[model samples]
Target chain A: MSAFRSLSLAMLKGLLRDRTASFFTLVFPLMFLLLFGALFQNDSVSRSHVLQFGEVAVLDEMPADQRRDLSEALNVEQVRDRDEALARVSDGDADAVVWQDEDGRIELRYSAADATRAGTVQGLMQSLVQSANLAETGQPPAFELASDQVEDKSIKPIQYLAPGLLGWAIAMGASFMSAFTLVNWRKKRILRRLWLAPISPGTVIGARIGVSLGMAFLQTALFLGVATIPFYGLRLTGFWWLAIPLVACGTLAFMSVGLVIGAWAKTDEAANAALQLVIMPMAFLSGSFFPLDSSPDWVRAISNAMPLKHLNEAVQGVLTRGEGWGAALPAMGGLLLFAAVLTAVAARLFRWDDT
Target chain B: MGPLNVSNAAGRPEPGATRGPTEALDAARPAPPRGPAPPRFGHGYHRQVTKNIPAIAVEGLRKRYGEVRAVDGVTFEVAHGEFYGILGPNGAGKTTTLELVEGLREPDEGSARLLGQPSWPRDPGLLRRIGVQLQASAFFEKLTAREQIHTFAALYGVSSRRADEMLETVGLTEKAGTRDDKLSGGQAQRLSIACALVHDPELVFLDEPTTGLDPQARRNLWDLLREINAQGRTVVLTTHYLDEAEILCDRVAIMDAGRILRVGAPSELIAELGVGNLEDVFLQLTGREYRE
Candidate 1:
């Protein structure tokens, strides 16, 4: 126990003293958060651009104020030539093309190249038609739609971004730290010296993992703490506290992944290559930066298989969607299973020295 | 005196001579006439009820990496408190042989017994009795020299005061707060040695501790090593420097191509081979210029 404690304390001190490691683990992801937060500062910012080439009655009949409000979410531009509008959408200049058929029915056409924007355009078109149909009756309906955010708090892009980015930060800190530490120790022959000590290898690894987990939790606190500042406008809600346990579960899983890479790679370059191959693709596809709802089915399918995807979803649900254990528990279960399997693989591949 | 007839050419008193069991073993066997001879291990000597065991004993130990025999069929012994050195050129299997004996790697064949206990299965009790310093110093990243030895001390359940005393013993008290990477090459080597001795183990192993140091730094480290062995601790070191082995070791093992060409006190090996020095001793054995 004393050995484990001293080793963990020493490692923690080492991490704190390593400026590059501290910057990459604790500060880099926050930079990403600030950048993404600033880019999507306004919640009402238009998501998709649509070109209306022909007279579409539903759009034409819309009130001026209502049209202005709709334009806030979707860029509706009127164009003269059908061919030109279709060409623009095909070339990815615009998201979709809107026209009316002889039957006076609204027709929306979109390109498959930008699947995420195409999905958004389709949803807006459906809602536009539905609202038009209801307004055509010109009567006060007995039942009306009443929509409000969960907990009645106005939601912003930062609120959604906070949880996803936090999950991402936790994954980065845990995995990279473990992988680099292992490879460096092996390269430096620290493992051999530790083997000569009275302490067991298990104790050394335990201390390392203990330090990694502590850094992980520190990242969680920093991410949430920074996001909750009034400037970022991230509001933590019901079951938001569940993120603590979820972060632990996710850190363990990613740390195992890192251990496997560290154990398999013989040098720093090889470990870097393996880390990039594993982490970069997962980050982009896991909906940490954007919603998977806009992604294509195949992309979403790949994202679904990634542990980071589940972590983002669970974190986003609790922090923004006002969800409880019902939503977070399944993700925790998946993360635990991921950690268990990867841990076994890490143990199988673990080597005390590069030789 | 305890049955392997290699004489001490330096005529120094037997290290740890006051130990009761060694005196008993000396009485049980007759001392042979002085001569230039390689040291040998009495096969069943340690199995006796007496505690007159050699600090290290290995017989026909071997380890192979693919087609290369890294430590092919080597055997040797070091008496208690003896300053021993394995001298060889690069890739001469010195490190591999040391590792096999240290219980850091399992031997492909044969056995290594440390202080009368089998080292292969890695007996934990034996670990407490031995210290190892690798060719490359291995420190916790970003640690200060003091913290490095302190953590090592903590692992062995040694006191922080003792760890600090070890720092002073290696003349590193002023550099105690210096980060390991910021230290000079010699300082790092001394810090590693301090860490190795922090627990005050009965046996210590150092591999190529002075390979890269300047002459001044190398001599400083030689003094520190001498002090360590003078404290009645068995010191086994491997080095490529022929003169270093001659200056520091009580007995040196000359190794080439994963085999020991000669093992005796430096003067004895030189006299027996009729060579002027160890460098000529190497040239006579391998018929090649000795290379670092």
Candidate 2:
């Protein structure tokens, strides 16, 4: 126990003294969050719409009060003909086009270029026309159109991004830091010196794991704090404390991979190559930048197998999706299993001496 | 097992009688009289006859790398508290021999016993009783001299004060706060020595301890080594400089082709070879060929 503590303290001191490592571990993730937050500033749950009306006769028949409500709900524009309205929608100047045929049935047209946004606009228009028809006809309605959003309107995209960024922080902290430290130690023959000490390899590895997990927690806390405290002030809900265990599991899962690379690679260059090869693809496919919903089925399949994907889902679930611990169980379990299996492999491959 | 076996001389139990699970159970039995044994110390039985046991014993230790024999059938012993040196040219297996005895490498055949314990066992207790400084003593770059010593000391369950004392012993007190990477060659070497001796082990192994130091620094290190030897600790060192072996070692072994060519006191070996100095003796034994 004393050996473990002393080694861990030494490892922590080494990390603190390394300026480049400190930058990547603590500062890099925060910079990423700030950049993404700035880029996604206008991202919101409720989207604005520009609706072009192809026929003036339909609008003239509506009551003045209903017309005002429709105008307020959308940026209502009157086009001379259907061709002009279709051009506006196709050119991305308008979200949709609405026209009433001679039989009095409402027709809707919109581009499916951005399927999610288009779907939202279509639902809103459908509800609006249904209510308008009922009021104008003065008849008892067969059914009511009621709607509820899972996310609150005030929730910004940055709020959703904060959790994924937290996972990003863990991935960078654990994988990059562990890989570099291990490779550097091996290159310097520091591992050889430690091997001579009256401590087992297990103890040395355990100390490293402890230090990496500690740094992961610190990175997560600092990133979240900077994102929420002085900047976005995003509220984390639904068993937010579970983020602690989630970060731990994620750290273990990622550090195990780093350990394997460090143990297998003979040089620092090789280690860096391996780290980049794994981290870059995982970062993109794991929903760090955008949702994977519209991604190809195979891409989604690969993302599901990634530990980072599980981490992002669990963190976003708690911080943005208002999900409890039960909702995070599958991801947490996947991370734990990944950590266990990879750690076993790393242990088998770990070598104290360069030979 | 047999009624009072005759092999159990001096009223001591037979070696086999104390094997396996019965050893601990029988430890409390009154020890047989062995000619006024020394007072037993913590965790170690100090039998009077233990003084006869050499600090290190190697018998026919051999290691091979494919077709090459790194350490081929080497055999020697260092008396307790003696300064022993192994002198050889590059690639002559001096470091390999040292590493084998240090338990850092496994030998293909034969065995080594340090402090009466087999060196190849996975027992860390043996490591606690011995210290080693490899040829290139790499350390944590950001660790100060004091912290490095403290870290290694903690591994051996030594106190922080002892770590400080080791720094003082190696004349590194003033540079205790300097990061290891920032130190000069001599300072780093001294710090390495201090780390090795932090627990004050019974034996110490130094592989080319002064390989890259200036003359003055080398002389200073020699003085420190002499002091360590005076404190009744066994020291085994490997060096390319024959002068270092002559001036320091009580016994020197000259090796070539993965085997010992000669083993004796420096003066004795030189006199036997009809040479005036170790340089001549080494050249006469190793010949004009460049091993490296």
Tens digits of per-residue lDDT for model 1, A1-355: 2899999988899888989889988999999888888788764323578899878897787777656656556778999999999999999898899999999888898999966567667777776776666566664351122111111223467866887788788888888888888899889998888888888878988888888888888888888888888878788888889988888899999998898998899887898789889888898889787766665789999999999999998988888778989888999999999989998998899888776
In the order shown, the candidates' DockQ scores are 0.58, 0.42
Model 2 segments beyond 4 Å from truth? A45-48, A52-89, A98-108, A112-116, A119-146, A150-155, B1-50
- How would you class the docking of model 2? acceptable
Q: What's the DockQ of model 1?
A: 0.58
lDDT of 2 by residue, A1-355 (tens): 2999998998999988989878877888789888888776655433535455555344566556545544433456666678877887888777878877778777788888877557656766666566556555766342133212211323466766787777877887798777877888887777767767888988887899899989987887776787776466577786877888888989989998898998888887898889989987898889876667567899999998889988998888887667888767888899999989997898899876666
Error of 2 at A143 (Å): 9.0
**Model 1 stretches with alpha carbons more than 4 Å out:** A43-155, B1-50, B289-292
Chain B TM-score of candidate number 1: 0.82
> What TM-score does each model's chain B reach against the true chain B?
0.82, 0.82
Q: What share of the true interface contacts does candidate 2 keep?
A: 0.67
